[model samples]
Target chain A: SQKIEQNSEALNIQEGKTATLTCNYTNYSPAYLQWYRQDPGRGPVFLLLIRENEKEKRKERLKVTFDTTLKQSLFHITASQPADSATYLCAAMNNAGNMLTFGGGTRLMVKP
Target chain B: NAGVTQTPKFRILKIGQSMTLQCAQDMNHNYMYWYRQDPGMGLKLIYYSVGAGITDKGEVPNGYNVSRSTTEDFPLRLELAAPSQTSVYFCASSYSTGAKTQYFGPGTRLLVL
Candidate 1:
């Protein structure tokens, strides 16, 4: 079975600083990977998606890096704000391209 | 667009009881999915539909049932609910598979006592 792992501990960072989150997977070579932000009691919202051939993708203040060789993806938030505090989830497309397998999200707290 | 909507924001059911979680999307997506999220765990796919009348089991579908009778609706049915079925359910839909962004619903929280 494919396994996705993210940092289980909460990441605390000061506002205006950069917050980086890690996601690692094994047993599958996904064609694409995605990142989502989830607030409490709400569903996850899409953030960014990076394909296997793309090493990095940027949108506003968010950036995602995919390393197929390492089977890892890094999510970064630049100039973080208090409102950016939320759980970050990482997911990868299944080999069949029909579904996604998500990692146990990493909670990020941007303190002002 | 309404995006995705789920009914019964929260519900508590007794063991062995049955209930259905409703999900609807106005985006006219071809793919819809049902997932359960437990505390400190990642979302587990229960069932998914490629289109109307085409459904398939996901990673976890032992105690759940789903039907996609229309393009806009995909309901999850829990028969003989157990404590293990207690979790937050989320419905999501995408335009198509392979790199399409998924829009999620507010979610339905279920508790089995």
Candidate 2:
């Protein structure tokens, strides 16, 4: 069976610090990995996407890294703020772009 | 644009009941999908539509049905709802080509009593 795992621990950090989240997968080789941010009582919003061949991709305060060999992806939020507190999800999908397999999100709490 | 919207933000249904979760997107995205999220679990795909008329089953499709009659609407129907059907249902839409970023609706919370 295919599986994706996250830290499962709530991360707490002060504002202006960098937060890193990990996602690991088993049994499936995906061509692209994506990250999403979900706030309370709301749907998830797209954050960033990193292709299998790409080592890193960045958008403003967010960055994503995909390591195909390790079957892992890392999500990072730099200079985070209280408004950045939310659950971050990692999803993987193959080249066909059909369905995505998601990992249980990691909750982040940024204290001011 | 209103983006993606789902109706009946919350509902309670008895066993063997039937209901339809409505989803409409104003973004005119070609790809639409239905997903269910259980407590502490990741989002599980129930069904997806590539276009206005094409639909396919995803990882979990049992006890659920969906139809895509137009580009803006994709409704999921639940027949004979069971206890296992209790979950949060979300509707999403995305552009078909190149780096598909999905926009999700607020979601419908269903509790089967």
Candidate 3:
């Protein structure tokens, strides 16, 4: 069976530091990977997407790297702030390009 | 633009009861999807529609039915709700598949007793 896994443990960091989150998957080959930020009682918002052919993608203070060989993806938030505290989800689009497999997600808390 | 919207922000239902969860998108997207998130778990796709009158089962579609009579609306129907059906349901849309960014709605929280 295909599976996606995240740390599941909450990550705490001081404001202005960098936060890194990991997503690992098995038994699946994806065309692309995406990151999303979800707040309490709200829907997830699109963050960044990196294609299989691309090594990394960045948007402002956020960056994402995809390693198809390792079947893993890393999401980074630089200059993190208190407002960056939320659950970050990692999703991979299946090779068919019709569905997405999502990891449980890691919660990040930035303390000022 | 009201990217996507779901009705009945929250609801509680008795076992065996039935209800419909409504979702609408004004962005004129070609793809719409329904997903359910359980506590501490990632979202699970229930069903998806490629266009009006075109619906297909996704990762988890049992106990749920959906209809897309119009491009702007997709509603999920729950028949004989079960305890396992308690979850936070989300509706999302994207202009197209394969790397397109999906816009999600606030979500609808449902509790089955």
Q: Between which residue pairs do clashes occur in model 1?
A: none
lDDT of each: 0.94, 0.90, 0.93
Candidate 1 CAPRI-style tier: high
Task: Rank the models by TM-score, top first.
Answer: 1, 3, 2
Query: What are the iRMS values of all candidates?
Result: 0.6, 1.1, 0.7
Please tell me which model should have the higher DockQ, number 2 or number 3.
Answer: 3
Residue pair clashes in candidate 3: none
lDDT of 1 at A64: 95
TM-scores for every candidate against the unseen true structure: 0.98, 0.94, 0.96
TM-score of chain A by itself in each prediction: 0.98, 0.94, 0.96
| Model 3 stretches with alpha carbons more than 4 Å out | none
Residues B1-113, candidate 3, lDDT per residue (tens digit)?
A: 87899999999999999999999999999899999999988999999998999999999999999999999999999999999999999999987756867899999999999
Question: Measured by TM-score, how close is model 2 to the native structure?
Answer: 0.94
For model 1, residues B9-111, the per-residue Cα lDDT tens digits are 9999999999999999999899999999999788999999999999999999998999999999999999999999999999999988468678999999999
lDDT of 3 by residue, A17-90 (tens): 99999999898887778899999999999999888899999999999999888989999999999999999999
Q: Count the backbone clashes (under 3 Å) in each candidate.
A: 0, 0, 0
Error of 2 at A32 (Å): 1.6
For candidate 3 chain A, the 10 contiguous residues with the lowest summed lDDT are: A92-101
